[model samples]
Target: MPNVPRKPRKQVAALPVMVDPKGQVRVLLITSRETQRFIIPKGWPMKGRKDHHAAAIEAQQEAGIIGRVHKQPVGGCNYWKRRSDHFDYCRVKVFMLEFRYQLPDWRERGQRRGAWLPVDDAADLVDDPGLIDIIRTLPKRLATKHKRLALKPATMS
Candidate 1:
């Protein structure tokens, strides 16, 4: 086979975690608008929003979710996008969001469905190996995050 040049991958921001009232960490998956494949809510960089904020916006638009998005990415993964007759490689940076209220209606409410699951179940549900690895580690990351948060008050002095 002849070697073919690959196009530069595009960047996207993804929001994958949701913390429940009981402190359980759940991962959110939304169906892709085009293929209905399960994926985290994701989108291209918005005009003025920061990367994580853009991810937050995607979470809202795609899943009717509103939450506090962490400034740093939890992980990244590469996937392919299908257009009319071509595939484009896309690199996604995933961020974690602290769960908050969900709106009854949102921009993409009719276009997709969102589901929350345990880290292991989420890993099984998503297609990307990179995402699965991140999902598998999310529980541990959440534990560390909660530990740090629990210590914040005592350390404030």
Candidate 2:
């Protein structure tokens, strides 16, 4: 090979969330293994899974949370992933997971910590600017989803 440039790795992330009884939305975040920097549940592509499904798997493994992952991705972000020999830039596609339940134990439970915070706080905690931008737009996207859901009953009848 003459001088081919390296392509950024593609990854998927789960934007796990729950809505309180009062209608406030909270987002779930986890710490990265090495640096312990706040981040969403994310990982590399799986051989037999679609991007969103893979994201759900990552959430389950990393955060011990299970949910329905929205088929359409909410947004995406890019971050530099540190590797042994060199660093790699990775592009992440974030899928929203509407949490159903949390497990008591999970694969990465001992290796990482997870937290649920308001979107603003979650945005503040994460170091990635691209991820922060995605977090900022989530509330509007969620509101639109809820409004559509609220109107569904009327249209059904």
Candidate 3:
């Protein structure tokens, strides 16, 4: 018998961001259930939803956030999902979700903690280099998109 390699599992994530009253960009991050480490909300793709929509759903479930998700993915990152016996390699596509409103209470409320942090602080909290890069480049990417769309700017309140 010969061994064969498995492909990386596909996943989706939502990068939830907002500009505060001071016009400072901030990102929302949730603590992982097991490790308690800061991470963006992500999960396996839903059967009936688009990738970006699924990412939005993940954000709602994991972080209790609802927002407008960009149709296009900004970037992707590969990570190792820990399992009981071994680790599974996963590639996650990241979508930017414009913050709308937060629920007073929602599912998974007590299981995890969510926080809004400055982009640089949020990037520094995450462990993955690829994810870090995405967070670090977010402000510029967002500004470019707003410019391309002919919007006033990304200094949304």
Candidate 4:
């Protein structure tokens, strides 16, 4: 049998975390407009926009939260599904980006709704374990890094 090239997978940027006052962390989950499934906000990269910009936009549009990308893309996961015309699995790649921002006042959107879940409970709310894991580690990692840097001593004159 001859080897055939598979279709290139599309890239999607997702923001899975948000921080709130009282120093608590939350994961922003979105109900899909069409599927009604709980998912982290995500979207394809927009023209002339940076990856982080796309991520922020997705967070606002899907979750109705205003946030900024906190770290470099942590990682990604790939899965396969059949396309409209075929029985073969088409690969899909989902990128993970951590976001730091505050929740916005919830107003009715076209069809989607956003919810903020405590970091500990986020995994159960999201369908994908990969996304869950991302939410799990984000708070500790970000907090530790920020604290460590903040506590570092200044160099001697």
Candidate 5:
């Protein structure tokens, strides 16, 4: 008898925090048809594509935003859920990327709309505090990086 191979685990990436020029920290939240709950924009990674490419595509399709992904990965998380008919816990890695543009015509996407809110307000909007924690940390991290760069000595020509 031949043995059947198990299906691969599912992985998803989410962008939990974004920043504006004003230095305000915000999160891009999406409401899906299957789930009424507001979740950070995310989707399964596409094969043969870079992580950031998947992230960018997910943002455009799910949130109707066209943007560039940051090079750094803020952090990742793991979670579990049932797969097919079998009950299983799957590990999903979360990523944080800032949406580089505003959605002037988000209605065109026809999937869902998104909004940017203060990190604190965003925390209140989402059900999971863990996600909120991720959003809240972004501002401090970006600010610290900016400060360090500003303090660096100027390079000689």
Candidate 6:
């Protein structure tokens, strides 16, 4: 068979964020199992899940935390996924997860290290350029969303 270039695989990611008492946005990042690089919780799309739900599941498994995940995508990033015999390109859709609480113990806790850092610091720590851009622009995106929400008329129900 002749070689043909494969299309980028689709993936989902959760950008877990919390606001400090000082109102600073902090992002939670986990170390990738193999590379130990800083990355948000992300994985392949589940067989029977909405993409955002799958991203939430990934966050629970990889980062031991859960939050309110936005239904719409905030942004996306492209990266090369290393496979056993080859590298595959992946496109990741990212959703913002409003931080709730963290579990003391969770799966993959031992396999990876998780940390909460200021947005700018986390943006600088991640290696993927696209992901970095997403992290950097997250605050502006959130502000835009908030403004839109404020503009909506209130409903009495």
Per-prediction tally of clashes: 0, 0, 0, 0, 1, 0
TM-score between model 6 and native: 0.88
Q: Each prediction's Cα lDDT score?
A: 0.72, 0.81, 0.83, 0.56, 0.58, 0.82
lDDT of predicted model 6: 0.82
Q: Per-residue lDDT tens digits of candidate 1, residues 99-124?
A: 66677778987788777776778889
- Show the lowest summed lDDT stretch of 10 residues, model 6: 148-157
> By the lDDT metric, which is better: model 1 or model 5?
1
Error of 6 at 132 (Å): 1.0
Question: RMSD of each candidate?
Answer: 6.7, 7.1, 4.7, 9.0, 9.1, 7.4
Best by lDDT: 3
- Which runs of model 4 end up more than 4 angstroms from their true locations? 1-8, 79-108, 147-157
| lDDT (Cα, tens digit) per residue for candidate 4, span 48-97 | 97766677667666655554454456555443323456433222234343
- TM-score (all chains, Cα) for each model: 0.83, 0.87, 0.88, 0.67, 0.69, 0.88
Give the lDDT of residue 64 in candidate 2. Answer: 84
- Alpha-carbon shift of residue 116 in model 4 (angstroms): 0.6
Task: In model 3, state the lDDT of residue 17.
Answer: 85
Summarize candidate 3's per-residue lDDT along 1-157 as a digit string, tens digits.
Answer: 1222378889999998888767777888899999999999999999989999999999888877878899999899988887777777889999989887776767778888878888999999999999999999988987877722111122211
lDDT, candidate 5, 1-157, per-residue tens:
1222354355556573554556556676776545556666666779998766776667666666655565445665444443456544434445665555545544435555456667777778776545667766767877877622111111101
Instruction: State residue 37's C-alpha deviation in candidate 5, in Å.
Output: 0.9
Q: Mind giving the per-residue lDDT tens digits that candidate 6 earns over 36-154?
A: 98999999999989999999999989887767898998889988887778877789999888877777778887899878888899999999998899889877877876722111111
Off by over 4 Å in 3: 1-6, 147-157
